[model samples]
Target: MEQSGGPRGPEGNEEARAAAHCYRHPDREANITCTRCERPICPECMISASVGFQCPECVKGGSGTGHAADANQPRTLAGGSLAADPRLVTKVLLGLNVAVFVAVMIQGDRLLDELLLFGQAATEPYGPVEGVAEGQWYRLLTSMFLHQEIWHILMNMLGLWFLGPPLEAALGRARFTGLYLLSGLAGSALTYLVAAPQQASLGASGAIFGLFGATAVLMRRMRYDMRPILVLLAINLLFTFTWSNISWEAHVGGLVAGAALAYALVHAPREKRTLVQYGAFGAMLLVVVVLCVVRTAQLTG
Candidate 1:
């Protein structure tokens, strides 16, 4: 059965947080229309922030808020639970990551040794070794899918189970995939920049963090409160800072790149969405080029 709720003072804040995650304005009186989704935004949940009366979408796309909703309307996540369908891109990525992990484990020491090139051989002096290095260049993206350990993959995959579908549905197949790849590469780029010559890092935490970053962009764009994403980001960052072996550099880098990329791609007028997309795609390519050059110089120098 479909369930709905009225604004319960501060008690319903958790609901509000979840709504904000999906780009919905949840803290409001339930009557105002969101500037992006065109759904009714509430007064409590309305974001008249940097973008004015407009909702989150306007904020992301650089649109200003213009209209106000009547006081008589309602707000709800009660609209419906988002579908849980596995996105094609999400499934493919998960599958590839798991398959590679299993292959590495099965090959025992030899295979595992060979696959872990970047985490070991990649350096500021010699760069990655040839042959496998050529193949491993793709590791910038592939590494995001690869896991440092069994539990690492499990945790990331679980997070994907919750966050991936909604994001894919909102952005559609192609853009979703693009965001994941670019965000992962961004994480890799930072790892390359910040890590010591022998410092090694692996896993999809960076890309997963990118998904979190994109979620934040969507929330602001739809005019929802940024508190939820902000809070979540904070907690995770705190964990990153405290934990051992977690590449805080990759996490921060991936998140910044993801948010930047998502803003460039997701924020724009409907009329200009296409243009924004093309521009964002170009910009992402440029970032990759920059990373490649910097990596080469660092390795050769």
Candidate 2:
């Protein structure tokens, strides 16, 4: 006869312990099993459910019965998939900015001239012209990664380090990357639209401001305390208007674009989330292109 709740033999205990480990991460011990699949899952692999926690696969597949096979998969708060390393995109962006800064330091002003945002200008006194107006539109993007002053790069990189990880995790790599690039382009387009044709500007401030805007939106959406980000944004905006060297146009443009994009990404209906999120991205890109084109026409025609 067998006794219930009695001590087991060594082989039996070892098998029991092995069964307690998470199916997805064998090394992790799990006290809870997925409500849908009944498989052991660690906290990281658990997705909160109506009754209890479910595993990623169950959430991706549909309901506890797993009936809707073709339904959209589960995603992050902003319709993005969770990543193994959430900070990968942030690290890459930081690395690119740093690498461009180092290259500028080594190559001197020549590289800076090629990379910085300028609407229209002659390369040399009385020489042939070159700039965004002359079809050097790449400057809008390259300029976001270019910085000359040590203080400029330091400030921007510090902002990136602080604001980047959370947004990357929330938005995932692809959407976060799209937001950054589009925000930067929006900034460049605005600057080109309003600033003097011959004015030169270069820095990551535009993209950084965009991150600031998106962060505020994300915090509000998650119902997190918004005071801290709001205070920081206020301080930055104050500096933007007060500091003579700062490009206020870029800051403002990025902030608006980021806030709009983030809102669309996080608040879209679950049934149509992907379409709305990506559609917003395409719309933002279209706006940027239109701005650039109108500015180019103003300068060239």
Candidate 3:
């Protein structure tokens, strides 16, 4: 007698046959086996290959196994899950900014001296910026996430909520985050170079300007109408120049950084895409570091 799921075979008097079935679709009888694994697979599970049909398992087995080599293909660590949703980066950024803002509100003016990017304002004539001269470069990054007032936080976060998702999706999580942080750092670098040592500056405007520039550049690259973004940028520039106590230097620096970074990402050749993009980003950051060193020397001298 032949088993229920097994293919029919010649049987001698009272002998039993072992049942065979598809691994994936157990209910369906397997007509063919995978060429590589030799495992039984139903019609739906078959993947046509050059030599013979393969099972779905066999095809997916190459991922992260060093067997596949495609530059643009997404990589996965061993036992790691799939790529995260693109929007996750945006949400996390917004959350961190908001949380820091609340902490600033609670800490009052106490945290300002530590968090705000005050460049020379902390030096000799203006009095030393506490953490910066003490080898704390983190203040530059801290200022980007700090918002002094409720409205300041609101406007910046609103801009992030509005613009971050699409940009994140286009750039992928790592690239998008690199663009954002580098842009903000560029803003602070410009601020350190130009702002009066005694003048304090904080807020996300510079970083926000970066996103604006990125959006415009990305849109232009995609052959989409950039008029709306251009108009919006113009309006913001007007505010940046006209508004009191705003660091136009940071805004412009961030805009330039973001645009440059986005350009590298958008135009990089597919074959050397990652290498080119990261190299451009590193070069942009190196320029900022040089600017910081030069400004520090000038201030100290």
Question: By TM-score, who's the top model here?
Answer: 2
User: What digit string (tens of lDDT, one per residue) describes model 2 on residues 104-223?
Assistant: 989998898899898999878998888999999899999999998999999999999998987886787798999998898899889988998889988988899999999999878755
Q: Relative to the unseen true structure, what is the C-alpha lDDT of residue 173 in candidate 2, on a scale of 0 to 100?
A: 78
Q: Native-vs-model 1 lDDT?
A: 0.61
- Compose the digit string of candidate 3's lDDT tens values, residues 1-301: 2332432234411122123456655564554565655556543454444344555555666522223332123321111112446478889999999998888878887776678787544434466445443456787799999888788889888888877866775676787788899999999988888887667778887888889988888777645567888998999899989998788998999999999988888677655667888898899889888988887777766
Query: All models: lDDT?
Result: 0.61, 0.80, 0.71
CA deviation > 4 Å runs, candidate 3: 1-84, 122-134
Candidate 1 C-alpha lDDT tens digits along 1-301: 1023344334444454445332252323243445444444433234433222334444445444433331122111211112234276688877888887887677764554344425236433565444222435665665676665788889888767656765665566667778887887878877866676456667887788888898788667666568977997899899999988888877887788778877875565544657877688678768866866676566655
Error of 3 at 82 (Å): 8.4
Error of 2 at 102 (Å): 0.5
How much does candidate 2 score in TM-score? 0.79
Query: Order the candidates by TM-score, highest first — what do you get?
Result: 2, 3, 1
